[model samples]
Target chain A: MDNLFYAMIFIIFLTGFWIMLRQSNLIKKIIGMNIMESAIFLFLVAMGYVKEGSAPIATEANPGLAYVNPLPSALVLTGIVVSVSVTAFALGLTVRLYKHYGTMDVDEITRMRSEEL
Target chain B: MITAHIMPLTILLPLVGAYLILLVGSKHRSFARNFGLLTTGITFAMVCYITYLVSNQGKMAYYLGGWAPPLGIELRADPITAFLLLTFAGVSFFVLLFAYDILPGEINGKVITRYYALYLVLLGSLLGIVLSNDFFNIYVFLEISSIAAAALVAVNGDKLAMEASIKYLVMSTLGSGTVLMGIAGLYMVTGYLSLDFLAGALPQAYASHPLTVLMTLGMLTVGIAVKAALFPLHVWLPDAHGSAPTSSSAILSGLVVKVYIAVLLKLLYRVFPLDFLAALPLQGSLLVMATLGIFIGSIMAIRQRDIKKMLAYSTVAQIGYVFLGIGLFSEKAMLGAVYHVFSHAVMKSMLFLSAGLLIKYSGKRTIADLSGLGRVYPIPMIAFSVGALSMVGVPPLAGFMSKWYLGLGALEANQLLFLLVLLLSSLLNGFYYMPIVIGGFFKKETVEIRQEKIPLGAQISLLVLIAATFFFGLFSNIPISFLTPTVQGIFSAFGGGI
Candidate 1:
């Protein structure tokens, strides 16, 4: 069961990678990148899992209880912020490229750009 | 005592300056340029002091908030770190100085303030990358620098630059994701992010989970190779570096790419056990890739008509030399790799700056149209010639010293073929570079060119870089000696052989 979880994560990551590499549309490419990032984030979060752990918070009622590791969660939060910024930036560039080339297709954009040169 | 604070201050001052510029310079434009110059100037001073302290007193580390590692982040500065920091600080200061006069003309006037802000952010983050001794901190800084670098590429606001910027953004992000995953893998196994702690734990982790350790190494190497533009993975570099503004190209080619190499150096030597690395086929793969990158990058460069594009391709080849030094895995080769980092930073930035000036004055961007430019623009042309000759491994120049060390390193590692590759690449380097110099000086004018007075600031910057090229060559022993102990320390663990 544990190996299956890791395998699923790997498959999801590969799916995203394929989308990113094979996509022709700029917007689709951005989506693929986000998907790829999400897979990594999931992998990170899963790494900190304890089999029956509760929230990492401590209280007077439970002084020394097992809790999920908090570090990976913290790392995941930073990762999400970075992912968002990259998505926004990539989207901005897509918008600009669309305006200049009048197409969202990567191949079409390359064609038009090379002809211009 | 004072030097202990210099490490953090070196990073923070530019960051603070960047924010200050963003706040004030949005209203006042001239203030941005002046403040950017001042910020880099002070940062350079602090970096020099750090280098002094490291050379005399050995390595130093600064922990945040007085919290020790395994819990808190650590910023360590050994001799190699100090050397890289000096390279970054010195080149950036001079590049900014060159930009003072040239940048306003090249980039959009409306974004001048924002450009300075991004430039400082990039510098601060690069210094942070050099100083950070923890995995997570390095990742954060790596993302910041990558964003800043992509933004700098797009700041020109041209269609080509914008396209290149997007491609770079996407590809570099992919690289970063892989790097992050690799870090996570290492952490999952070792439960540590600090280099010292990781070093202690990785061997044990490898004992139990060998495949994970191997996968992490592969991922990290592949990821950094993409960012560093090592041959087959360098699809994004030429377009991005060729289309960016002058100073942006200088920084991207000269410093940004090198910092990733610095990170890889730390990962290979400090985090992983050398014996384990040697036991794998890591050395062979690295050498093969380096050799391929060297040859292909040069051949492509020779085919380029655009001057900037040609230089961009040349950078791809030069990077191979650094990787070659690393792959050789000998004491002298590693020293050569580190020294090449410094020499190439100086030489390439000087070449880019001079090329920028030539393009500006000549009103042309092709190698063919730059004939008779030598007489009209002696300073920039002369600077360009010196840089080109240095690239060709001309004796008594900085490039020669690096190639010499790298050649010696190849022999030390019993890799005679790579020594031949070194010599052949130098020849290929001349094939592309010599024509520009010869045509610029000896050939008659092809197109009538109007003369413009070169700015004193630009002149001063190029002269300083030219002097630096000679200084490093003449006193190559200084940096080589300074880096020897660090390189020796890394190799001593492996019994100094592959």
Candidate 2:
């Protein structure tokens, strides 16, 4: 069952990667990248899960119960921030690129740039 | 205890500088430049002191917020990290100096301060990448530097710059994602982010899950290969480096790309044990990729008409040399690779600065159009000639020393085929590099070109770098001593000593 969960997550990640690599539109590529990043975040958060686990926080009641690992959760928070910044920057660059080239397609941009050179 | 403080301080000083520049120097252009210089200058001094400490005290690791490795992030300063930090500070200072004069010509005053602020943040992030000892910390720093570097590439606001920046962003983001996934894989298996702890736990995990380990290595290598612009993965380099401002090109090529290589080295030797590496074909494949990078990078460089783009391709070839040294894996060869890192940093940055000077003064950027200005702008041309000679492995310059060491490494490893590749690449380097020198000095004037005086700061920076290239070549022992222990540290980590 655990192996099945890992497989599902990996398949989603690969789908995102395919879209990122295969897409011609810049916006689609960015969306694909976001999807890929989300898959990793899911994988990380899943790693911290414990069977029948409650919140990692401790209180007087049920202190002996299993608690999910919190370290990966903490780590993924940082990862999400990084992912957002990269997406923000990529979108900003896309805006400038569209402004200059009048196209949102990577193929058109490449063709136009090479022609200019 | 006092020495331990330097490890985190090296990263912190640059962070403080970036914030200061953004807040105080955002409105005033000159103030931004001065603040950036002062910050980098002080950081260089601190790096020198840290190098002194490492030489005396050996490896020093600092924990954040007074927490130990498992609970908090750790930053380690070994010989390699210290030397790399020092090189980063020195090269960045000079690149900033060069940019001071050249940026105004390429960009408008409105964005200049912001550009400096981004440059400071980029430098800080680079320092973070070198100093951090935790897996996740390296990923965070890598993203910061990648974003800042892409912004710097597009800061010129030209069409080409924007296009190049977008291409670079997409490729580098993929690289970062792979790296993050790889790190997550390691963390999930070992339950540790600290490199020291991971090293201890990895061998046991490796015995149980060899395929997982191999996949992690593959992901990390391919990710970093894209970031480092290794061979087939280098599509974004020429465009981004060529289209960016001169200073950005210099820093991006000279230091930014090499930082990834350094991180890869740290992982290869520190995080993964040598015996484990023996089961993998990483080194063998690296040799093939590097060979392609050498021959193909040079051949492509020969086809470029634009001077900066030509230099950009030459960088691809030069990176090929560093990887070749790594592929050899002999003690002497590894040393040569590390030395080449320092030599190439100084020489390449110097060449870019000189080329910037030529472009600024004469408005000529093609090899054919550079005629007669050599006689007029003798200082920059002479320095450019020094850089060209060094790249071609002319004696008494740094490039020659690295090539010689790489050759000796090939002989020691009994991979004589690489020796041939090294010689052929040098010849190819001469093919592309010498024509510019010859054209500049000997060829008759084809166009009406008037020489303008070189800026004071840029001139000083170029001469200093030229001197450094010579110094590193003639007295190669100084840096080799600094690098020997780094290699030894790796070897010792694997229960071997050089």
Q: List, residue by residue over B1-498, the lDDT tens digit for candidate 2.
A: 545588778788878888887888767778888888888888888889988987887777788998998779988887877778888889998898877777777787878888888898899899899988888999999999999999999997888888889889989988988888889889888899888888889989888887887788888889999999999999999999988888998999899998998888778777888767766788899989999999999999899888899999999999999999887877778888877887888888888888877776677778778777688888878888999999999999999999999999999889999999999999999999999899889888777766466788888888899889888888988878877866866655672211
- What are the RMSDs of all candidates, in order? 1.7, 1.7
Query: For candidate 2, what's the RMSD?
Result: 1.7
lDDT (tens digit, per residue) of candidate 1 on B422-456: 99999999999999999999998788787788888
**B-chain TM-score for every candidate:** 0.98, 0.97
TM-score of 2: 0.97
Give Cα-based local distance difference scores for all models. 0.91, 0.86
Candidate 1 lDDT: 0.91
Q: At residue B26, give the lDDT of candidate 1.
A: 94
> Worst ten-residue run, lDDT, model 1 chain B?
B489-498
Best by DockQ: 2
